[model samples]
Every structure is written in structure tokens, then in C-alpha cells.
Target chain A: SQKIEQNSEALNIQEGKTATLTCNYTNYSPAYLQWYRQDPGRGPVFLLLIRENEKEKRKERLKVTFDTTLKQSLFHITASQPADSATYLCAIHNTGRRALTFGSGTRLQVQP
Target chain B: GAGVSQSPSNKVTEKGKDVELRCDPISGHTALYWYRQSLGQGLEFLIYFQGNSAPDKSGLPSDRFSAERTGGSVSTLTIQRTQQEDSAVYLCASSLAGQDRTSWYEQFFGPGTRLTVL
Candidate 1:
């Protein structure tokens, strides 16, 4: 069975600091990995995506690193703010499929 | 231009009743997807549509659930004889295209319809 796991425990970090979230998968090799931000009562918003061959991708204050060797992806939010407090999800695209299989997600709380 | 849009932001229906949820993908987007999100759970893939190709229904939980995308634009997911377990938020997303050669298909999601099967 294929599975993707993220840190279930909520992560708390001070504003202006970097917040890091982890996503690990097993039993599959995805063509690409994506990160999304979801707020309460709203659908997810795309953040960044990195291909299997790519080591890193960046967009504004967000950066994502994909390590196929480690079977993990790390999402980073630099200079975090209270507004950045939300659940972040990691999703993977399976072979021959464009749909994403998402992990349970990690909740990050950026305190001012 | 408007992004993806779903109808009936919230719906509360009795168990065993049939429910239909609608989705309008972003204009010009050729790929659409449906997903279910239970409380405190990850998004569950439900279905996918790309252009005029046959839909990928592999993620549908059961035969009671079915979906159709008309004219490669608007889509509707129908649940017959819904059960209590059907209570969840149904999300719709659209991308330009599905092939890897196209731009990375970054999905733009709708606000979602919250279906409460009571």
C-alpha cells in the first residue's frame, strides 16, 4: 500500500522565523510533489511544486525541496507571519496519473 | 476571470436521499478533478476529467457515487441513496491540461460544497 505521512503534531514557531514541515512517502515513486495551504473553512491553495528530478523550487517566501533518495519533501516558510498559520498539505502525482494523492497534512501556527 | 466554482456552499440532507453537487471549472481549463475531505482527514481523490477522454473513476468509493462532466466544462457528482458516511466537503479543481508536457498542472480549487448527510 502507498502511504504519505506528515508530522501529525502541530508546529509552533515565532513570527519572522522559518517554519519547516516534512512529508514522507512509502511504496511509490511520484512524478512530482506539490505543497498546498489550506485555511479553516476554505479549499486548499497551491503553494509550490517540485519534480522528481528537481532538488528545489521557490515561490516568494516559500521554498520546497524534494529528495527522491530520502523519499521525503520539506516545505519551508521563511519570515513566517501570523497570517501564514494554516495547515500545509503535501501531495504526490502517481505514474501515468495527473491527480494528486495527498498526505494528512501538518498544521503550523505562527505566533506573533 | 473567475476561478473554479461549486454550487450550494452548504447542503444538509437526510440519509438515503440523493444529492447532486455541481462544479464549474475555470474557463479554458481542460482538466477537472473531484475530491472528498472528511473532518480531520486528508483529501480523498474521487475522480478526474481531461478534455474528452474517459474519466478516471478509480477513486470513487462505491457504485452509489457517480460523476459526469458535460461538454468538458461543468461537472456534477451524483450520490444515490446517500449514507451518513457521505457527509464531507466535496472539492472541485481545474488545471490547464493533464499531460506532463503541458505546464505543470497546478490545480485551482473551488470553495467546495459541504454536504451533511444527516
Candidate 2:
């Protein structure tokens, strides 16, 4: 069965540092992968979408790297702040599936 | 400028009772989806409505769960005889469909309805 896994433990980092989150999957080849930021009691907001062919994508302070060979993706928040503290989710859009399959998500906590 | 909206931000119901959750997708969004998220769990796909097509009900967990989209805009998900396991946050999302491949995969989600079955 296809599965998506993220770090279940919350990650705590000091402000002004970089935070890296990992997403590993097995048993599926997705056409594209997306990242979303979800705060407590709110819906997820789209952050970035990286296709299998693309190795890396960046938007301002956020960067995502997709390595289909390793069946993994890395999400990075550079110069993190307390505001960046939230649960970041990884979602994959499998071929022929209209809905995305999401990972359990990794929670990041940035302390000032 | 409005995003996807779901009614009843929070619902508490007794076990074995029925509850209805409503979702209003953004204007012109042809694809709508419903998902459930239990505590500390990933989002579970429930149902999908795309234009006039017959909805994909494959993700529904049981026969007691049913959903309908009226006039390709508003949607309702009904869970009959709810059990304690039915407690979760129900999320709704919508996206553009057809022609634009990029836009099709980017979904805009609404603040979920937190349902508690006691």
C-alpha cells in the first residue's frame, strides 16, 4: 500500500535558523507534490507545488526539493520566525486520482 | 474574493443521531472535495464532485455516509447514525477544472467543521 510519512515529533528551533522537514513515501509514483501550511484550527494554505521533473522550487523564504529517485521530498524554511511555526503537510497527486493524498505532517516550533 | 465556505463551524451530536454538513465552493470552481481528519491523523478523502460528472464515492467509509452536490455549487455530506468514531474535522476544498492543468491540482480548502459525536 502507498504510504506518506513525516516526522511525528514536533521540531523546535530558534528564530533566525533554518528548518528542514522531510517527507518519505513508498509504493506510489506521483506526478506532482504540493506543500501546505496549516495552523491550529485553520484550513491548510497552499505554499508550493513541485513536479517530478523539477528538482527544486523556491518562493521567497521557502524552498522545496523533490527527488523522485529517492522517493522523498524536503521542505525548508530559511530564516525561520515564530510566525513560521505551524504544521507543514506534504501532499501528492497521483495519476488518475482527483484528490491528493497527504502525509501526517510535521509540526515546527520556532522560539524567539 | 471569498474562498470555500462550510457551514456549522462546530457541531456536537449524540451518538446514533444524524448530522448534515454543508459546503459552498468558490465561484467557478468545477471540482469540489470533502475530507475528514481525525485527531493526529492525516486527512482522509471522503467524496469528490467534478462538474456534472457522477461523484466518486469510492472513499466513503461506510454505506451510512452519503453526499450530494446540487446545481454544481453547494454540497452536503450526511452521516447517519453517527458513532463515536465519526468525530473529526470535516474539510472541504475546491479547485479549477479543465484546460488549465496547473490550476486543476491546486486546491483551496475551507476552515473545517469540527464534529464531535458523543
Candidate 3:
């Protein structure tokens, strides 16, 4: 069976520090990977996407790296602030199917 | 532009009862999807619809779960004989089109309907 895993432990970081989240998968190869930010009591909001051929993708203060060979993806938030705190989810599209399989997600807390 | 929208922000129902959740996709979006997020869990794919084509219902958990899209726009997800395990926040998202790689069809999500089956 295919599996996707993210850090189950909550990460606490000081404001202005970089926060990195990890996502690992097994038994499947995805054409593209995506990251999303989800707040409590709300749906996830799409953040960034990186293709298998691309090593890294960036948007403003967010950056994502995809290493298909390692079956892992890293999402980084640079100069993080309190408002940047949220649960981050990593997802991959299932081939031939329009659905996406998401990892458990990592919760980041930026304390001022 | 308006984003995806869902109705009944919250719903509480008894076990064995039926419930219907609605989703209105963004105008012009050709692809719509339904997902369920259990408490503290990741999103679970439920179904997918594209234009006027037959929808892909492989992700539905059981025969009790069914969904339909009308005129390629609005969608309804119906759960018959709802069970306590069905309690979750149902999310809806839409993208411009499916199978288009050139333009990453970013999915826009709705606030979701939080269903509590007791």
C-alpha cells in the first residue's frame, strides 16, 4: 500500500527563524507534489507545487524542494512570522486519477 | 473572482440518518473535487467531476456515499445511513481544468461543511 508521512510532532520556532517541514512517501511515484496551509476549522489553501523535474519552487517567502529519487519533499518558510503558523500538508496526485493523496501534515508554531 | 463555495457551514445529524452537502464551484472551473478531513487527519479524496463527463467515484468509501454534479457546476454529496465515523469536515475544491500540465490548475477550496454524525 502507498503511504505518505509527515512529522507528527508539533514544531515550535521563534519568529524570524526558518521553519522546515518534511514529507516522505513510499511505494508510489508522483508526477508532481504540492504543499498546502490549513488553519484550524478551515479548509486547506493551496500554497506551492513542484514538478518531479524541478528541484525547487519558490513563492515570496515560501520554498519547496522535490527529490523524487529520495521520495521526499521539503517545505521551508523563510523569515517566518506568527501569522505563518499553521499545519502544512504535502500531497501528490495519483496518476490517471484526479484525486490527491495527502500526508498527515506538520504543525508549525512561530512564537514571538 | 469568487472562489468555491459550500453550504451549511455546520451540520449535526443522528446515526442512520441521511445528509446532503452542497458545493458550488468557481465560475468557469472545469474540474470539481470532494474531500473529507477527519479530526486532525489529512484530506481524504471522495470524488471528482469534470465538465459533462462521467464522474470518477472510485474514491467513495462505500455504496452509501454518492455524489452528482449538475450542468457541470453545482455538486451534491449524499451520505445515506450516516454513521458516526462519517463525522468530518467535508471540503470542496475546483480547478480550471483537469489534465492540463502547462498551467498548474491551482485548486481553490471552500470553507467546508463540518458534519457531525452522532
Candidate 4:
């Protein structure tokens, strides 16, 4: 069965440091991969979308890279702040099935 | 000044009772989706509504669950004879269809309705 997996269940880092989260999938080749930030008890908010054709994408303080060959995506938050603490999820959009399949997500905690 | 919205932010029901959850998508959004999040688990796709077409109900867990979108704006998900296992946060999301290819239904989600079948 196709499955998406985030590297860790929880990560803790200093506020000024960088946080990198990894997402790997198996038995599936997705056309596009998206990242979302979800706080406890709230809906997920869209963060970034990287296509299979694009190697990398950036928005403000965040960066995402997609490697179709490796079947993985890496999400990075630079100069992370306490506000960046949340569960980050990576979603895949299979070619014919556009509805996203989300990973379990990695929880990040940035301490000041 | 608007995003996707869902009603009854929290629901508490007894076993064998029926419950209805409603969702109001952003104006003009052609696509709507329902997802269930169990404790510490990833979001599970439940159902999807795209315009007037028949919904993709493949993700629905069982025959006891059904959903409908009326006039392309509002949607309702009904769970019959709710069980304790039915407890979870029910999330609703909407997005514009036929938008940029890269976005590929970049959904805007609503603050989910937390259903507790006690």
C-alpha cells in the first residue's frame, strides 16, 4: 500500500535555529506535494506546494524541496521562532486523484 | 473576509443517535472535502464534492455515513447510530477547481467540528 511518513513524531529546537522536517513516501509517485501547518484543535493552514517538476520552492522564512527520484520532500524553516511551533504535515496529490493524502505530521517545538 | 466555515464546533452525542454536521464553503469554491482526524493520527479522507457531479464516496468508512452538497454551497455530513469509535475532529475544506496546476486544489480548511460520541 502507498504510504507517507514524516521523519519524527516531535522535534525541539532553539528559536534562532533552523528546523528541517523530512517526508518520505513509498509505493507511490505523486505529481505534487504540499505542506501544511496545523495547530492543536484547529484546521491545517497551507504553507507551500512543490511540484514534481520543481526542485525547490520558498515562501518568506520557509523552504521546501521535492525529489521525485527519492520519493521524498524536505521542509525547512529558517531562523525559526516560537510561533513556528506546530505540527507540519506533508500531503501528496496523486496524478488522477487530486485529493491530497496527508502524512501523520511532525510536531516542532521552538523554544525561546 | 471569509473562509470555509463549519457549524457546531463541538458535538456530544450518545450511542445509537444520529448527528449532522454542516459546512459552508467559501463563496465560489467548486470543490469541497470532508476529512476525519482521530487522536494522534493523520487526516483520513472521508468524502469529496466537486460541483454538481456525484461525490467521490470511496473513502467513507461504512454505509452508515452519508453526505450531500446542495446548490454547490453548503454541505452536510450525517452519521447514523454513532458509535464511540466515531469520535474525532471532522474537518471541512474547500478550494477552487480548475485553478493553477501547481496548486492542485490547495484547500482552505475550517476549524473542525469535534464530535464526541459518548
Best by TM-score: 2
Against the hidden reference, what TM-scores do the models get? 0.97, 0.98, 0.96, 0.97
Cα shift from native, residue A47, model 2 (Å):
0.5
List, residue by residue over A8-111, the lDDT tens digit for candidate 2.
Answer: 99999999999999999999889999999999999899999999899999999999999999999999999999999999999999878889899999999999
Candidate 2 lDDT, tens digit per residue, B1-118?
9999998999999999999999999999999999999998888999888974545878899999999888889999999999999999999999998696989999999999999999
Question: Model 4: per-residue lDDT, tens digit, A2-112?
Answer: 899996569999999999999999988788899999999899999998888999999999999999889989999999999999999999988888588999999999999
Instruction: Considering only chain B, report the TM-score of model 3.
Output: 0.92
Using DockQ as the measure, which candidate wins? 1
Q: Where is model 4 more than 4 Å wrong at Cα?
A: none
lDDT (Cα atoms) of all candidates against the true structure = 0.92, 0.94, 0.89, 0.91
Please provide, for model 3 over A1-112, each residue's C-alpha lDDT reduced to its tens digit, 9 standing for 90 to 100.
8999999999999999999999999987787889999999888899998888999999999999999889999999999999998999999975565678899899999999
Model 2: how far residue B17 lies from native, Å: 0.9
Could you give the candidate ranking by TM-score, starting with the highest? 2, 4, 1, 3
Where is the poorest 10-residue window by lDDT in model 1 chain A? A91-100
Q: What is the lDDT of residue A4 in candidate 2?
A: 97
- With candidate 1 superimposed using the best TM-score fit, by how many Å does residue B47's alpha carbon deviate from the native? 0.5
Candidates' chain A TM-scores: 0.98, 0.98, 0.97, 0.97
Question: Interface-residue RMSD per candidate?
Answer: 0.6, 0.6, 1.1, 0.7
Per-prediction fnat: 0.79, 0.79, 0.76, 0.74
Q: Is the docking of candidate 4 incorrect, acceptable, medium or high quality?
A: high
Q: Which stretches of candidate 3 lie over 4 Å from their true place?
A: B98-105
DockQ of 1: 0.88
After superposing all C-alphas onto the true structure, candidate 3 shows an RMSD in angstroms of: 1.4
